[model samples]
Target: MLRSSVHDHTVSTVPTREPRYEKKGLKAHRQLAEVQALQEAGQLDEALKKARSFVAKNKKEPAGWRNLGRVLIDTRQWAEAKRALDRANALAPDNPSTLINLSLASYHLDQFEAARSFGQQATAIEPENPLALNNLGMALIKLDDFDNAALVLRRALSVRPDLAPALSNYGAALNRLGQFSEALDVLMAALKLNKSDPYTFVNIGNSLRFLGRDSNAIDMYNQALALDPGMKEGSVNICNVYNKNNLFDASFTISSELIEREPKYVKAHSVMADSLIGLGRIDDAKAAAESVIAIEPASITAQALLVSLAARADDYDAADYLRAARRFSDLHDIYRPDVLANPADDAAKLRIGFIGGDFRRHPVGYFLKQLFTEYDRERFAFFIYHNAVEYDDLSDFFVENSAAFRNINNKLDRKVAQEIADDRLHILIDLAGYTKYTRLSALVHKPAPVQMTWLGYYASTGVSEVDYILADPYVVPDDCEAEFSEAVLRFPDSYLCFSEPDCDVPVRPAPVSENGMVTFGSFNNLNKVTDNVLALWARVLKATPGSRLMLKTMLLNRQDHRERITQRFAAEGIDLDRLILEGPSPREALLDAYNKVDIALDPFPYGGGTTSAEALWMGVPVLTKRGDRFLARMGGSIVSNVGLGDWVAEDDDDYVAKAAAFATDAAGLIDLKRGLRQRVLASPLFDGRNFARKFETLMTSAWDAYRARNDGEGR
Candidate 1:
């Protein structure tokens, strides 16, 4: 979950005392006291009337204006409060009381910089004022200055250890900084002091969510909502958690209700889009995302969603995806920093940094395991900048193998980029493009002289700072070069190298022989199986009689998703009896499940990557239709690398024809199945050592080019 909104504490007011005014200002002091009393009594209208009368009589006195601002704040009139506060500040420059009120008013007006300035002035004047420090910290938090916010909040806490508001804000800063455990501790302390503080509960929920305790996080959010039923952040956060966990129905329900209540809620619309994407409702997802864009034109999340959706749309090709990606890039234009200097030495050990948020049992992690384990560390120093809170054994492997491993989950994009720039990496590779928790924003800072995007994401990042994209000749053909924003650096054979599965599950014989029928399956995410892919699969099932298509993915765990898939397939003239839909399973079970299939049907426009490799590893030949873009061509790359290019089809007709013909040849099918695993294992696709050598060579080549360019420019 992203950082939850911080609810500022009630504005602190100073005692109204006229030390400067003598006997002549006695009446003014009395009037100020009366206004303060009325404001304290919550009679804001009466207080405002009295304050206006006092201000009108003593137009030059800062006390009257300050009292007026305080009453305006009590009435939630932020703009007028700011005006009055500004008047008071102009009258009594550097007055701690007036400055504090100005800070609060500015913060409410969304003038965070002004708020910070006022807070700084107040803190400078009264060094140990808890209210000044607390307000300063809150403003810093709004500005994504968590490091400074944490420091200021720490000072506030030191001044008054039981300052619950300071404690809550400090916990929020800790959460953003990626110190979930410490954040939880601080927030829990705050909760003890003020159980009814809804924002504290939300902050605690964020910490729990970051710690991978989704259920506990949900409970915390519920606690927050229970305290304040009108807390939109708490409701939106719960929807976010539900979406993350693939509870699309729940997320959709909550987001829908939120939209009904408040149609302009951008976060709710964004989560609704996420839920729609998970449910394979791409068109609806696009609409939801468009709604977000309409509401917030510069929404990075919505633009990124459109990029992914366009890539998956059959009607939308690479050009459309690029357009969407570039729009997403536009949102980060403000974040772009000056390019860091190139490394001076040409022959030194090239320090290569890999930045992403998926070094924990994800497909990206699996793909990188072999490379990390087998790469020539002597020639290239590896640096891992992990940007996620969750880490498992795979993460440990990365840490153990890398020269330096930093968990940058808590740092802001600019700080992460600065850290990377400070590291002076020769080449930095972005493993995530626009995926969740992506650190792609760091790449915009141009932290390294040579930056490229490789695995994890299929399409071009459209980030101008990204110099190249790792590809193979098959996945990125010459004709498609124009589609990518980055220069394509093609490998000789396959761009990816699969790690041999650790499990020793023996490949079973073709299921067609035992069952007297062909069992075609696809274990990739349902979202990848677009409407066109489904219709094509339906045709394949129709062409091959007595065939069953087994579709298993995480989304199938939801009954609504299963029904949706069944309905879509039924509309394509496929019967329910011939379809087999199953939910996710353990890795071992998933691999073993492939034994029941004779052939695997790969989805198009966004074909399987790890799933395709896994299918081949399980002796199931993946029948893939070639596509125009990298996302659609991955299956062809994998299958061709395995010397089974015949399984790759040119179009829908060819796909159905291949499936039908392959099923008819029962003997050939069994023999192919028996030898498929060995074929893949012996091919370049599984050659980790070979892939590492080529990878290192490419890195060296790219670095050499970078140096040559810089030298030509006299850098």
Candidate 2:
């Protein structure tokens, strides 16, 4: 087994040979011909030996240096090849052949810009040259300029229609640009010219994978590996397809093998991180993300992953993650403010925009119905910019409710930002704040006059372009504003406004009386049930005699999560029989599970938002231990808003006491359950009519504040 990597900084600074450039004599040319003959006979090492001897003997001939460079390239000695080519170019500075080989060596060395420069110089010297054009296009593709790469490669094919390399590279460029059908056509053309090209097969697999043809993509990747067993590109694509199919174990196997083969392979480490997360190994996922950051300091995605994992537990405060979020500010440090089309405009029409990833069957979508449907249509022209692929009935409702809807899933962040600016939105609201598949980078351009973040995240997003965070007095207090990057825009009662769930299930009487033993439960995400939260829940169960805890989550289906939960409880002296772990079920069945419990428990520091509301709506009162941060206090706000502030505990002792008291008072529990839904319906949490008015006022105020700031009339 071997683990190693090749990086751009590992190349030697000193030249491996003497620097000389001149076509010396006919003797040098004849020696070069002999070296070429050995290379053409499939003897790269022999050719390298002969070329080195020729260059050492004829030290002044540029032709000898060029021949040595060609042999070095064939031998896969990129650094030495670059040095030889550098010496050749120093002597014969105008030779297209020297420049072309220099570009090839640079490409192998991962010096993409240098390769493009050398290839461009060669093309300038010899117009309509297929070799130079194809090399330049491939270099641009490596640099992620896919649109121009496709154009350049197409021009190269026009000069030499049957050039297989150009066709293959063109297909890769189109595939990257999301033109999968066109890429397949170009790749098939390339395959007809060269049937054994492994990379062309990998590119075709990539196109198929992006087109959602996972089974076909896997077959193509296997074909690529069959042609070249050592091709990492094909293996990496296979791992990606496995992940797409939710086969995390298979993804882990292939990615781990790639990592063992090359420890510093960045893509392999990233894929491994995703696999780790899917398997519910938070600690391992964090470590994998850290490894990526150690390899490349500019990896914002890895940093985001680490922060999100830390936030799931009580490992750090909001201020800590808030500062970490500022790392993404460097992504567009050179961006200057563009003159707006509606600069210092009047308030005849206030256009508001909401951009998010989860406009589907998620908590954000559940809460967005009122805000989108109940807006004052004449006062505000609402727009939606969806950044995700998930679309369902609620998503269609959002589209129907809004004045305009645009799907920006395939657009680049900067391009989406520019389009938002073109739409002349007065206030752009971000519903996806660092959540999965969010386009947080788009807000860096500050497309609207005012930008606010809401719903998707619980704490400060730390993006400087976000002017405000829509919160409530209970969630974010006046003193906590210093910790946030954005201004804390407050609502009087609660920041949340949710509609009812789809279940017709009604609250039942206390289950404690029927079962003769209290059953406490938590329906929050398994990841939020951190070690600290689990330890606290153990104490609650211990305080209540004969009480059992019911934990249900999607991860409970995995044996690992179930085993881990059992081990944690064992440390607390709690029996495995007292714990009921259930996997995911249908929506109606999940809501019905609350009937089996007397009370629900909320995890600390990252408490439930929708889970708490749903539990209250289902006649199960949740006891949450309040903390200092917004995420920790979300349960408190919801309970306080629902007229049951006593259910939210002030500390750990209070939490355990509340759970015991609620479980023992069977009569009071029955009474609370019977009237729980009506209580919530009467509270501000589900009062969509009042929430809509307040939201409209908030947007109107934000617009006025923006106009005042721009007009030099400070608010």
lDDT of 2 by residue, 344-438 (tens): 25545678889987887899988888777677877778888987655789889988888788877646666778889888888889987766655
List candidate 2 segments past 4 Å from native. 1-27, 33-41, 57-71, 88-104, 116-137, 153-175, 178-195, 204-257, 276-284, 309-313, 330-332, 336-348, 388-413, 502-514, 712-715
Could you tell me the lDDT of residue 517 within candidate 1?
A: 93
TM-score of each: 0.94, 0.84
Query: Which candidate wins on lDDT?
Result: 1
Tens digits of per-residue lDDT for model 1, 350-467: 8999998888798898888889989987788898999877789888888899989998875777788878878878889999887666677778888888899999888899888899
Q: Give the candidate number with the greatest TM-score.
A: 1
Residue-level lDDT for 401 in candidate 1 = 94
